[model samples]
Target: MSGRSDKKGEMMMVQADTRIVDVIRQMQEQRKQDRQIFYDIYSQQEKRQDPEKKDTGLFFFRGEKKAPFAVVCAGGGFYYVGSVHESFPHALELSRQGYNAFALQYRTGGAEVACEDLAAAISFIFSHAQELGVSTDCYSLWGGSAGARMAAYLGSYGPARFGGDDLPGPGAVIMQYTGHTDYTENDPPTYACVGENDGIANWRTMEERIENLDAAGIRTEFHHYPDLQHGFGLGIGTSAEGWINDAIAFWQAQIDES
Candidate 1:
């Protein structure tokens, strides 16, 4: 490891082999200035009613102030949260593109539980959007694998359907390598990407999703990468690299439509 002076004129450790976990750890260590973590977002009634609600939270990786944001959920097959692989890398890339991004930690029993936490996280963000210096209009929902299911569900059914306030659906939904097949004509504009060799989530399933979205009159873009696997976060050196830029372009188009 080596140390270098950052823009703040403070020395920071530089890792020779940088990884997404390293970036996220750096952000966590520098949370005082780099990231904001919101803890335990249950409403007063829910907190009082269900005394055992988990303490999952949201980690915000900010970009341009007042920019529309994307809420990213990582995949863990409803058992764990893979933020290191799926959330932080995506958020970091989105931030690099000048978009505010949040990586959410949801209760991981299943999609239903995870979606509830996502809904609460979105509600929390919306409630404090002004203070957070983010615009609520045309924000995006991004997820990978199981998390993609959560994002897709919310994109199809607004927050209110999942016990949150009746907030507008995300302007765009970015899904990566998930077997999410459900769709509606009202689904937000979607950008989907999958690897031809993704054993976990079939490329054909994603193709079907795109077909359904297109048939239903939803604006969508689908990319099929060659020789990539399920959880290729940020794509790094893989064939799926640079997909985030295309997703951002899709999101910007949605904002323009708004």
Candidate 2:
């Protein structure tokens, strides 16, 4: 909410209950700086094989150069990319807190395809870390709902498990409002949150996932906010509003450990 005051009028266009897609469209329409909001991740030849690939890109909200970076994937239920609500807002907040953040826009065919895009995106960032002014030494992966599933899958299985190049797992994983419970032994430390009343992404399931991760000896932190709903990005004004800062601290602790 650091810079939201400047965009108060534009932000008032959407309410807490607004659908994520509508909110994203409104944000995109009100965007003033185009250069800060768009980035292409695939080459023309790659897009030629799948026209949807042309839409795939990464919108970066940069923080301190050479700091550990985060790749954020937004939730769209495998039907759309909710970059405006889930991606950009989270990335903006993380950047404000001095963490390099990238909001990924990937093909939306299904979880598998989206995960492949995420893996490739991570590989691309690592390959160009020096030029991008980001450090590959201790990056994190963050996601919401379906995107959380992607993040968890990548953290547990590594990028090579998907179709992308073989790469080291992220140092940490941050998930929000996801029902995905699958995990592998010794997965990356995780920080998760979900609204108690969220119908789409069950908070109970998330709790169970956390318990399981803890039982497996993976470091875990979770928060269940009272009376909140799904897709509450950065949880502004809600009980979960400050959870991003907490997640950042958790990620930093992992970096320190590494």
> Which ranges in model 1 have alpha carbons more than 4 Å from their true place?
1-17, 25-35, 43-52
Number of clashes recorded per candidate: 0, 0
TM-score of 1: 0.87
TM-score (all chains, Cα) for each model: 0.87, 0.87
Which regions of candidate 2 fall more than 4 Å away from where they truly are? 1-37
Q: Each candidate's lDDT (Cα)?
A: 0.83, 0.85
Candidate 2 local lDDT, 62-155, one digit each (tens): 7898888999999999999887778877787787788888989988989999999999899888887887789987789999999999999999
* Cα RMSD for candidates in order: 7.1, 5.9
lDDT of 1 by residue, 95-185 (tens): 7778889999888778887898888888988998988889999999999999999999999998888887889999999999999898888
Considering summed lDDT, which 10 consecutive residues are worst modelled in model 2? Answer: 8-17
Alpha carbon lDDT at 14, candidate 1:
19
RMSD of 2: 5.9
Root-mean-square deviation of Cα positions for candidate 1 versus the true structure, in angstroms: 7.1
Please give the distance, in angstroms, between residue 18's alpha carbon in candidate 2 and its true position after superposition: 14
